[model samples]
Every structure is written in C-alpha cells, then in structure tokens.
Target: MTDAAAPPGEPEAAVTDGPVTERATCLLAPNPSMMTLEGTNTWVLAEPGAREVVVVDPGPLHEEHLARVAATATAGGRTVALTLLTHGHPDHAEGAERFAELTGSVVRARDAALCRGAEPLVAGELLLVDGLRLSVVPAAGHTADSVALLLPADRALLSGDTVLGRGTTVVDHPDGDLGDYLDTLRRLRATVIDDAVRVVLPGHGPVLRDPAGAIDFYLVHRAKRLAQVESAVEAGHRTPAEVVAHVYADVDRALWPVAERSVRAQLEYLTEHGLI
Candidate 1:
C-alpha cells in the first residue's frame, strides 16, 4: 500500500478553477488547503441560448467571492435564477444564502436545514433550469445528505465531495458511513457506464474530462484500502488509531486525524461484514 493512492495516471486538476462542459463554468474560491486542494468550486450552469443560469455550490461566505459568482453568471446578460448545493459542507454550501440574496435566487439542498426559500432537493428530482434538465442523484458518502447532479444534456456529473477531482474522498466517520459510501460509488460507477457521463465537475479541484476513469479509480482505491484495513486488523491492530499507524504509516502525520476518521468508518464496515 502506498501513502497516496495514485490517480490512475489521470491528469491532475489545475489549481485554478476552469471551464468544464460547454454550459458549466467553475468559480474557484479563495480558500485552499490540504483538505480543500484548490478550494471550493462554485459551478455556474446555463444553456447557450438561455438568459437564466443555475449556480451550484456557492462556496464559502466570502462576500467578494459571492459577488463574483453573481457577476459571472450575469455576464453576457445572463442571470442566476436557482442555487443548488451538493451537500451542507461549509466550503460548498456556506455562502449559499448570500449568493441567493445576490442573485435573488432560491437555495436548494438535500439537507432541509441547508435550504433557504426553497424545498429540499429530492433524490431523482428533475429540475429544468434555463431549458436544461438536471437529474438529482443521491450520493450521501462524505455526508449523510450529499448528492450529485446529472446533466443529461452535456453528459456531465456535478459531484460534490463524494467524488473529488484529485485524491480519494474521506468517509468522514460518524457522519460518513463506509457502507453507504461504497454503495454511492458503485451507483455512480453504474451511471458512468450506463449513462455514459463524459465529464465530472467536482466540488473541488479541476474538472475531470474522464468521468469513467475517475469513478473507477475511486472504487478501486476504496476496495484496496478496505482490504488493507482488514489485513491490519487481523494482524492485531485492534484500534482505529493503531490500524491507521500501520496501514497509513507512509502518509503525512498532519493528515492522520482525518485518516483516523475514515479508518473508523472502515473498521465499522469490516465489523458489519464480519471480516474482523
């Protein structure tokens, strides 16, 4: 096992946010760190012929950034009419209400508490914004209420933290369930295969042109990590921290806390599966 799971030789996403499909433009946030590789990505979606656009993930509560997102959408005489959140993570949804106020749009999210002046997003819900259809898919890995958007028109997927553009996403323990995370990845993989989704617009990092490859990488990485954890446990690493020290020895110490959270989720999953 390696300290970092290699990204299948896929191109690393650019540090700056960039355009994805024809209709989606990513507005990168100012915040960047180990967890938030580049920063939160605020995606603005619009049809070429429409005046109304839809903004996804308003990012953090930075006033200037919020204003920038509004301005970007309103460029070329287009206006933002709807705001959607992939999840309730602060980096992704913290500025939603402010962005809604800026664009005079309603904010919608899977978590009811995250919704403002709009109904919670439902799984399988069909949304028609600017003459484009966005099919909501329940993701719920990084968080219990996480979701990813499927744009059939462009064959693009707006995946939140569930499927990032860079490294493997953490199954955030307590709130993040490893079992459900695996299910979500499997489901997304099936969508990539059956629907032929070509592009992945992640919540962070650069846009992925190879959706299938990214999904396959995530699924494989998760499986390999689970096997390593099982092996570590069978080798007498009974605690999550002990397992982390053994299985993630090569990983940076600063990330051990985050790794422990995922390790806990993995332990729970193994226990449930009777693998330890």
Candidate 2:
C-alpha cells in the first residue's frame, strides 16, 4: 500500500490480448478497482493431452467476467474441470460459485464454504484435473484462509494476494497477522530459492518473475515499515491514524485506509511484544 515505486526485479506482464485458447493462457479483466485490483487474472491452464481446463480465481461475481472466462475455456475445446481460489476474498471468490454453476465444474479451495463440495486444502495437497496438477500451498497471512497453488509442470505459482505484481499486500489484523505473514514469505522464499517456482500469477496485478526476490523485497519492506512505525510511536505518534501520517507520510493518501489496517497490525504486534 506504500507509494514507493515497485522494487525492481521482474518485467511487467501484458494484459491478455484475446481469448486464451491454448494450454497456458491468461485473461485479465478490463476493470480494475480497489476491490477488483488491476482486474483479477483468470488463468486458464491446460496440460498436454488434457481434456479439461482449470480456472484460477474466478474473480468478482461480475457476469461479464464469468462470461469471458467461460468463453475462453470453451474456445480451448475443454470444459472447466475445476475452479480454484487462492483465498476467499470476495474479489477472488464472489464469482467462484456462480462460475461453477455456469460451467458445471467443482470448485477446489481451502475454504469449502467459498467453493463447491467442501474440501480443506492443506499444504502439499496435489490436485489432478485432466493431468494438470496444482499443489496447494498454505500461505496464510494476507488472510487466515490464504493459499497459493503451485503448478510443478509450469513452475508457476498462483500466489493470489499473498504476493503481487505491483505494490506489497496489506496485512489486516484480526484475520491478518504480521508474524504469520512473515512466515509465509519465508516459506515462499524457500520455494523460490529452490527454483521450484518460475513465475507468480497473483490475484491482482500482472504476473511477475523472480518470485524469491519479490518475496524478499516484500519482507524487507515490511520490516522497514515496522521499524518506522515503532520509531513513530516512540516519537509521540501512538494512535493508528497518527502513526500512518508519520510513518507513511510518503505513501499516497488514497491508500492510507489500507495502510492504517497494516499499521494497526504493527501496533498490536509492538504492544504484544512490549515494544511501545
């Protein structure tokens, strides 16, 4: 949520130009909003000789979005075998059920309430849909329900909001904790370092390379922000709003609301640790 320029690493990905008709294609929604985010990236993944398609993040419940996704999958001459959610945020899940209804596909997610035929997706769970394998990785932090899907064949991760192509993600307290978030980053870093992950297809924003570097930068940024918040609190900025003004002075005011949530999380962490 900081206004700081995105740390350099991977090149930006272009929006999907046309219908995704091949094995690996992505369609970016045209609309981008604070809620929708750089438009949810609906990934259509297929494997060699596969007869079905896998849809990652059905995005908002927008009729047009679902229609586009269906059209793209149908163009590939395959039925939508499954719908996967990285997390249960409405932006990412609101349309999952509806999309499943439209495509007659079952939804697989860590949160069953968010998808079809309730199944908890724990880490290291592999799902095979028409020979296209996606490994569920529990990356809780952005939300308690957050998870990332790892496609070993493609060496790609559908990171959802746990990682992003633009700015860093917010850690809303109560459901979002900085400690858990940092742990998730560390785990993701190990995956990146092992060269197991080649690219990140996030819930919002474009795709990115250098998954390890991006996760590292995000961790470092969070540390720096925590320090700044600690310093601000020591320098007489105690309330969340006051800390936001001081610690995030350079960040765009439009995003301060989101920043405030992270700031509150940091404050709780500090208070729990007797740092304030």
Instruction: Specify the highest-lDDT model's number.
Output: 1
What residue pairs are clashing in model 2?
none
lDDT of candidate model 2 versus the reference: 0.79
Residue-level lDDT of model 1, residues 1-276, one tens digit each, is 113664553655484455667888888899888888878888989988799999999999999999988898998888788899998888988898888888888889999999888899999999998697899999987789999999888998999898877777888889999999889988888888888898788887766777878778888888899999999988999988999999888888888989999999999998899888
Can you give the lDDT of residue 156 in candidate 1? 89
For each candidate in turn, the TM-score is 0.95, 0.93
lDDT of 1 at 242: 96
In model 1, state the lDDT of residue 194: 86
Clashes of each: 0, 0
